[model samples]
Target: MRAAPARRGRDGADTRARIEAVALELFAQKGVAGTSVRDIALGVGVSEGALYRHFPSKEKLSRELFLTRYATLAAEICAIDAAERELERKLRAVVGLACALFDAEPALFAYLLIHQHEHLGLVPEAPEANVVEAVAQMLRGAGVPPGRVTLASAMALGCVVQPAVFALYGRIKGPLAAQADDIAAAVMVVVEGQARG
Candidate 1:
């Protein structure tokens, strides 16, 4: 009956969610290239065939997971760019958000950070889904020279990202959010192009 179908749908959705969660954990622990569909299926407590009922292949699942999370972060960064007008304030907001996310969900954040290169080319071409473009757009709006925008954006993002990387490797102690203000200031230096020999 209809009730039986509804229950199956709920179970199917739960199974899919479990698959995604397990896949992300494995992907974080082992690089995407290192993780296998069997690994994900085993972790999720589902048969390999059942996993395929949700994702056709491991590559598709990895791409889907990467794009989904990356787009969410990109959208958030775009929203921050849209809301803040001042350059320093905008930098602080964006940096703070990145650090907070790293602290809140280290596995998800690490997955995104480490696997970005593998998946960036697959990202859809949309301003709201391109974090780099969003940061560049913010820099341009803040009066950073057109010629400098691209480099400045990379440098600015690095000011936040590198710390998270260091924290990930245990070289840095404590939550990244604690360093947000300093990171923001460092990003400002990049944006301003404060020359130092």
Candidate 2:
């Protein structure tokens, strides 16, 4: 019997993903500055050379991981069907999605939040800007004032979502999940208030 040839692309992608996952776990446990490529390779049961083949350097890998996660989050947020729903429902949907993402990958969220300032400079500015724009569009679709849309979006994201994530994952003692509904409701109130007056 002839042996089947390995699928190079699929195998390579799997290996790369494994390397990234292991690297992220290590980075989360030990701060990025404390983790090394050799450590990542060892964790993934690959040689340093093999790891380098997938990611040229640790810094490059970290940046790629950060941007990839952020892009995924932005995509989820942008996919909300705000135009098809009531403003309250839309706001709840957005908040629910944000909470689910944070809960699903709290470690990644924590790592990104903690290191955002340092890694922000490395990411393409467009994706983050696009997230803000998407938020503005969603708010506009909800009948929020054009002038207040950006501010409302910023407050929901920066004040509400960010703190909620930290409270959920950080050392701060609080029932983040318990407060999710209230937070969503509060955000909706702000949006509705802006839309009405």
Candidate 3:
């Protein structure tokens, strides 16, 4: 007798979620520029057609993945902005939150960090809803000068996020969360320096 035909996605299975998970892993490991739709489909244990049913193209897949990851981080930034009132304290909270997120979802963190420059244009509403904009807006709202907002944001994010990349490469010794204080301190130095100008 012939075996049962293979199933498409089940009612609750949501192959789309699997597609995103596998795509994120491949993108995190190999970079979006290196990973293809075929690779993601293979990793998800689905045919290319199945994957395409979920995502029309590799570029669409990459942008959607980036959007999800960035949104998660953006939500955290929104919380930090709402909770903290001072620039220095808010920055410390941001770094601490970054470290926590890095520890919890390093791949997502790394994926966004790794691909932001290339995929920023691909993702819609990126500039207005991004981390830089969040930080800059926080600063602007706190009476910080417009010119200083950009520099302070750059300094804050770079200080916190660079070490996350280092940790990913094993260049850093401990979990990203463990370096929160150091990261926060370094960010404060930059923010303070920029504010003094």
Candidate 4:
């Protein structure tokens, strides 16, 4: 039996989504500067004109990817923050959720990792987008002084982000959910030590 012919979407939303997905995947595998409209169009099985119809330029596509992905991750963080009480529990839950997000959408994860320095400025500069602020607030609630909390928050965040970076590179084995407990333990150690000092 032969496979049926693919159905092209009429609403245009499907094509737009496919363009973004293929573009992000290509950008992740090959840097955004390295990938072209033709490449994204080819990956999506559409014409370069169709890619342009969805995104005016490759830079525009990259920016859209960042804004969309960052908003999604920010919402997930907010949900975790609202439900969890303790600092350690919140940290673990966020990290575990982040890992799952990364696992499910590695291309978006890689795109952000590769373009962070260039693209972070474009993401909304809200408290929800700032992990360090969340950590600092948690520290303040736990009795750390305001000025000192920033440093501790930064350090604690390193515990969560650095391992995820390594995991992206295949240096760390298995799913991130598996490492949530250890990551939380390490983060708490850093936070608590700074609180004591």
| TM-score comparison, 1 vs 4, better candidate | 1
Encode model 4's per-residue lDDT on 75-187: one tens digit a residue. Answer: 66666767888777877887787778777888887787778787777666564764445556567776677767888877877787788889889999888778888888888
lDDT of 2 by residue, 1-197 (tens): 23334577677889998998887787777878999989999999989999999989998898888878776766666677533466667667777776665667666766677667767665554533345566677888777888888788777677455665567456545545556788788887777777786
Return the top candidate by lDDT: 1
Backbone clashes for every candidate come to 0, 0, 0, 0
| TM-scores of all candidate predictions against the true structure | 0.92, 0.80, 0.85, 0.85
| Candidate 2 steric clashes | 0
Q: Model 1 over residues 116-197: C-alpha lDDT tens digits?
A: 9998998876768888888887888888878777788888888888999999999999989988889988888888773221
Q: Report, for every candidate in turn, its global Cα lDDT versus the true structure.
A: 0.87, 0.73, 0.78, 0.77
Worst 10 residues of 4 by lDDT: 1-10
Candidate with more favorable, higher lDDT: 1 or 3: 1
Which ranges in model 3 have alpha carbons more than 4 Å from their true place?
A: 1-13, 122-128
In angstroms, give how far residue 69 of model 1 lies from its true place: 0.8
User: What residue pairs clash in candidate 4, if any at all?
Assistant: none
lDDT of 3 by residue, 124-156 (tens): 444335667777777677666778888787777
* Candidate 4 Cα outliers beyond 4 Å, as residue runs: 1-10, 130-144
Report the Cα lDDT for residue 44, model 3.
83
